[model samples]
Target: MSAADTKAVGPPVPVPPDPQPTGKSSSDDAPRVQKRKRKKGELLPYFLILPAIVAIAAVYLYPLSKTVIMSFQDMGRRELWSGEPAPWVGFEQFTNILGDPEFWWVTFRTIVFMAICVTLTMGIGLLVALLMRKLSTWVRLVLTVALIAAWSMPLMVAASIFRFMADSDYGLINTLIAKVVGEDWLGHNWYLNPVQGFGIITLLVVWGAIPFVVVTLYAALTQVPQELEEAAALDGATAYGIYKFVTWPVIKPVFTMVATLSVIWDFNVFGQIWLLRGNKPEPEYETLGLYSYSKAFESTSFSQGSAIALITVLLLSGVAVYYLRQLMKTGEVE
Candidate 1:
């Protein structure tokens, strides 16, 4: 063989590393895409919900913060009229309210009144809800319409209507009673009689509050499975038995939630008493709500009034916490 041919060609030239991938690859873009997606997901809900957060802050948080700050201060007419900050007094306002015998009595009476009103409201509301469930379509429609009318009436309007109904001489109720029971019962002043006075107020409250509870409970009832109800009937369950065992379990949570709400509402009721009296209500019939209003505006001791309101908030919050604990036990929420 020729010498040149016999000398082996130089080892095959080595290939250069493939030019580092010049264009972006799908894999290289994956992390960026995932991060962008995560950021969007995190921000979208907050953006979507921003208006609701703002509304809550405006309607609830602002007033609550103001009340809390006022409760800790020695606020009065000067602060209210001038919109100036009041002097801080620590817990003195609370201490003063708590130390009063009359305040204790008022608290006790208010509790009793709230309990009665709430019980009546719930009982009537539950009854109406049950009735609504069984009613024929037309009847249910009429009843619903009536309930809506009652529910939508403004608080002041309702108070005025109730006051008209309770007038000693001209009220429709008094007129009817007088007609039925003779001249002796004529002109019996309901507002002056403690039993009748409270009874009237309770009736007014229950009448007004029932519509909401019934509507909520009826909506919950509609969600119940008809198959389970039918199965229960086939098992020879009585109507009441069906309700107690099969229906109640499904609806109890809503019932409990409404009841708690009703308690808070009834406890804080002020319009009924005030409007009924056309001014500050008589102390004998006063609740914490009315008393607070009178103290703040009438007496201009804003701090003491705010203190009462704070106590009411604490009470309701405690109730809410207990309701939440019960809800947790039922696994209604995480």
Candidate 2:
């Protein structure tokens, strides 16, 4: 064949230019493989958290179980002195508590107190957080520190101070009231009146609890993307409309959490009532917390007190679970 024809109709043979080694390491590949290995090794974090889980179970669950068991037993000094096995009395304590008129009254009072404290705390906290959001950083920090200082003070100390301040004879409040409303105010015994006493306790509780709600709500408020609020503003939404639509929806979960926690804390309150009212059942303001303590310590019905305590725990747990489910729902939506 001619050279041109041979070139145009060449044989279909492939060209072998380079030979590469198989199963050989490359410099760039080593770091990538090592990074993958490092990631696989990082599963130890979950194991490290196991200790905290065990500690919580030991501290809270163990005592809760013991309390539940003791609620069924006739546990008291008499049982201890006799050195005899206390017989199991299933549901008797619960029934006695349920049947008692005083229990219902105390429970209602507790509900009212919880409602008042939770509402006031959440409302005031949200208001303060909104106001603080507009302030300078230094002012916000100072106010936050002051609120936390109030919250960090011991509950007993706060209750004692409130009690002293409300005393008709020597209380600073009474002195001020006397000056404003004349000397007749000095004769009024604030502690002796159930309404007045409960009102004071409610005020103290609200004051102490506002800090937690405020801090939590403030943090949640800050997390609300500023862009969203700006967009709403551009859309000609009113100030209240922006809050209701953009700001509130973002912080609703935190609000729910704070409210639930406030309810739980208020329902379980013991210090203020005990410090103010002693063991006597105030006809208008007796709370289940005080009633339970009185039942167990004063009346020596330990089983009944345990039953009441368990009921309180169950109610609070239900509330916590409900709100947690709501938080989870919010997360899913986001």
Candidate 3:
């Protein structure tokens, strides 16, 4: 049994049988493939959104950060060329702006103007919307077309149109007045005094804004249940009562949202005033927007201008804070 026989009779080394395929190999490959696909699926949304994120960062974030940093620093003509960071002045620009009486006056004027413009625009818009609800379909179509045209008109064009309409010699209003009343009122300046000037500007802004208000409010009005008004009316409610209880509440949220937007817009109205006054609107009627522009470009005071802009933004944020908090709490916006 020893060495000679070992080759012939050695305990059979069990040559391991070739493993049978359980078909698990193909299934295992399938799971790996599925995992790869899952990874790809997870990454696809991010890839889709990456371009938007990059675009936003480039357009909004970069400029916003630059403006914010520029506001805090003494950025001027030298920094514009030197390509170096300007000296950081803690609140000096802010102080200069705050200390100026002209800033205070402009701030007050802006608030007043915003209040008046928002009121008139919303009021007139609401009236137009209510009228639209009662109008014949054909008339509604015509009015809607006209409104779309008005709304689509550029701000500069609108301002120019209004300026011509309110012009001293060849103005439509004065010409009509002269034809009806007397030639004495024909050559009168519609924009002579600051009060009159502001009024004219307000008229222009409100005229432009009303179409938007009419469209949004009219849409909201259509959504309001007519049955509620009828029910209230049938229950011996007066017209005023029905409107007060039924119509107002339904449109209140939308009205509020639109008004807020209007205030924000009108408060920062530069193009309207600038173009209306032929680019030299009296300082008395100027808003913070115009003030900032005058400082940054006209006076070459970029830091001060940035400070004023920051202030304006802060002020608007303050106005919107309540609505924003309410929106967040409700998880809804009108």
Candidate 4:
């Protein structure tokens, strides 16, 4: 305990203060890290969707934009003398389409054709789908294969086959009719009359369209909850009643989708008509679709043809908007 020893010992060492964070607590730091990770995770989804968005913009939007632009310009064989730069004729094409009696006639025919084809296809498809649901697995498989085979056939090939079958001289239809009616069925052309031609076209279109609808409806039907159906049955409802109350409501969305797709397809129908009637505007059976093709290629009125196409687009778009609104309302109700 000498003075020298006490001085050497000095005061007890002071404890060092804990280090402080720059601006954040440990808890705050944890949240920041988590937020950064979440931001990264959110970006991954957009990156995945970017390719699809780009592809759609390139493929669909670009062509649609071109069509819109072309529809506004008077770029036809007759209009070439106007200038290298086709003059902007605002809505002249639209006005022409509206004014033309032939356009109106074709539009009416198109609507009637679409209505008949869509109704028949949907009805037959639903019936077939219902039948499919009750079938044994093997039978269902066979039927599905057969249906897909029919659906997978090339459109041109199908049309050619149908044309052959419908021919006046060598057609299976005529042969069958002769066998039954004891007359020369091959003496007259089936497609010479507009009504008969349309009937045959309707049959062909319906046959081609039904397979897709059947597949879609059947998938939707199978997804219906068995529990709901059974509960419906227990409530003393008949089979039809159960279906009406329970199944139909469940399948309504799918029905709407099918109907919308069918309408679009029907509006754009050109191949079938072209195959049946070579480019000529039939006296009573010209559709807007066929009319557009004939104008563009056969008549060589590109601007007018483009105008017809735009009119068809507008018509279909109106229909689509109506159905989309209905679909949205249905979603809200559900």
Candidate 5:
């Protein structure tokens, strides 16, 4: 080879290395991209529910906050009408409510009323639910229709119906009782005595509440495993024993939930009593709801009413917490 040619090829020219990709590989970035998409997916549900949250805050939270504010102040008819601020009295309203003898009496009466109504509603509903399990398809269908019909009836209509049926004159109840017992029940003023008046109210409350209880319990009962029940029976367990051990454990959660809800509902009963009493429930017929209404609207003691209502809310919250704990223990919720 010529010297010049050998000189030209003295060394192979150094070439720059090919550039590597910057940052990360597509595989390495896959998770980050997926993470971004997952985050977006998570946020979608909250966005969907945002409107509901806003609506609920406006409808319920605002009034509740307003009530709490009013409870701290000595708000009355003047302040309510004038839209001016009321004098702040702190806990004086609550103190007054606690000290009042009539308030304690009303509390006692309300507790008793709730106890009686809850007891009857649960007991009768359980019995009805059990009976339904034994009924033929046709009869069960009939009962289901009746219960739904009763449940669907508006509170106002139900109250009116009950009122007419319990009228002092020309009442179907009085006529039936008189015919059966051969006693003069006609023109009997049920409201003359607080006990009798409360009895009627209790009946109305239970009648309205039972259908819901029955339906809920029935649904719970249906979920009980037939295999377990059969196994219990095969082991020579008695009817009551099987129920106590198998059925009860299964239905207990639902029963407790229903009972808790019933307590909340019964504690707040007002419309039926108000309607039955012609919009002026007697002091003897007064419950927590009615008492609050009486204080706020009738007496124009808005702060005191607000305090009473706040107390009721606290009590109900305690009840709700207890129910939630029971559900947790039963594995009904996490």
Candidate 6:
């Protein structure tokens, strides 16, 4: 071939060296690498919550376990002071408490009291919330302030004030009643009758609880669609009917939650009764908490007290589970 016809190869174009390769395909390794990273990310959340979990276990779980253990033992002042293991009675404490007529009566009283307080709290709270919705800006502000004040008052202080108001001598309420009814109300003991005494306590509880319920319900109410309410009204629905059809459904979840909470709190009422009855609540005033306290401290039956408290916890747990189920049904909880 002629030199002019020869093509220039340029040192054979230096063929690129074969790309280096690992034993594994890159695509196959990708997923495994991603999985390792994902696992590391997942662990971060649990690590972040570890402190909270530890605190809860120490504060709540520890005491709860101790109470459960004590319930099965014959722990008394002796064992409590000496820090010695009490004799294990193995459900005898539970058996005795469950079999006792007084225990049953106390439980019954507690349930009744809880029902009354919850009903009144829910009813009054809802009414107040509705009223707040209708109120002008200034009136609602005033009402909110009043509610906050009531809610901020300490429980002991509220109980003491109620007790003083119901005092046999020189009580403001008695003086007002005497003047209004022209009857000899001064020096009249309200605690002489159990029914009257409990009624007063119920009032005190409802008063303190209404602020929270009203605030929560009112917040929920504000989120309700006014257009729906107006449409219902235009369809010839009464106010109550409009509320039932449009308003209630929107606030029902909140209402249910608050009512359940009220049941829990009222069922555990101790301070109010204790203070109202001069710190020595009579047999007639014995609810589950008072009964438990009396059994533990007054009679030095710590095991029986623990058993009663455990029973109360079980009862409250049932209420809590029901509330959780309701929330789940409403898609408010997972």
Instruction: Give the 10-residue window scoring lowest on summed lDDT in candidate 5.
Output: 325-334
Per-model TM-score versus the true fold:
0.82, 0.82, 0.81, 0.83, 0.86, 0.85
Q: Worst ten-residue run, lDDT, model 2?
A: 277-286
All candidates: CA RMSD (Å): 4.2, 5.3, 8.3, 5.1, 4.6, 4.6
- Report the CA-based lDDT of candidate 3 relative to the real structure: 0.87
The C-alpha lDDT values of all candidates are 0.86, 0.84, 0.87, 0.85, 0.91, 0.91
Regions of candidate 6 where Cα sits further than 4 Å from its true position: 1-50, 330-334
Candidate 6: tens digits of C-alpha lDDT, residues 92-153: 99999999999989999999999999999999999999999999999999999999999999
Candidate 6's displacement at residue 164, Å, is 1.5
Q: List the residue pairs that clash in candidate 3.
A: none
User: In candidate 1, what are the lDDT values of residues 1-334, reduced to their tens digit?
Assistant: 6768757665468888877877999999999999999999989989999999999888999888989999999988888789888999999999999999988888888899999998988888888888888899999999889989989999889998898998887788878877898866667788787668888888888888999988998998887788998999999999998899888988888899889888888888887877887775788888898888878888899889989989988878998897787777667542
Tens digit per residue, CA lDDT, model 2, 14-119: 9998878676579879999999989878877778899998999989998789779878887786975787777799988888878988788888888888898888
Query: Which candidate leads in TM-score?
Result: 5
Point out where model 4 deviates above 4 Å.
Answer: 1-46, 78-83, 278-283, 322-334
- Going through the candidates in the order shown, the clash numbers are 0, 0, 0, 0, 0, 0
In the range 207-290, model 5's lDDT, one tens digit per residue, is: 999999999999999988989999999999999998999999889889998999899899889898999999998888899999
Error of 5 at 274 (Å): 0.5
For model 5, the superposed segments whose C-alpha errors exceed 4 Å read: 1-50, 327-334
TM-score of 5: 0.86
* C-alpha-based local distance difference test score of model 5: 0.91
Query: Against the correct fold, how does model 1 do in TM-score?
Result: 0.82
User: Candidate 3 residues 145-253, lDDT tens each?
Assistant: 9999999999888888899998998899899989888899888896778898888899989988999999999998987899999999889999889889999888887
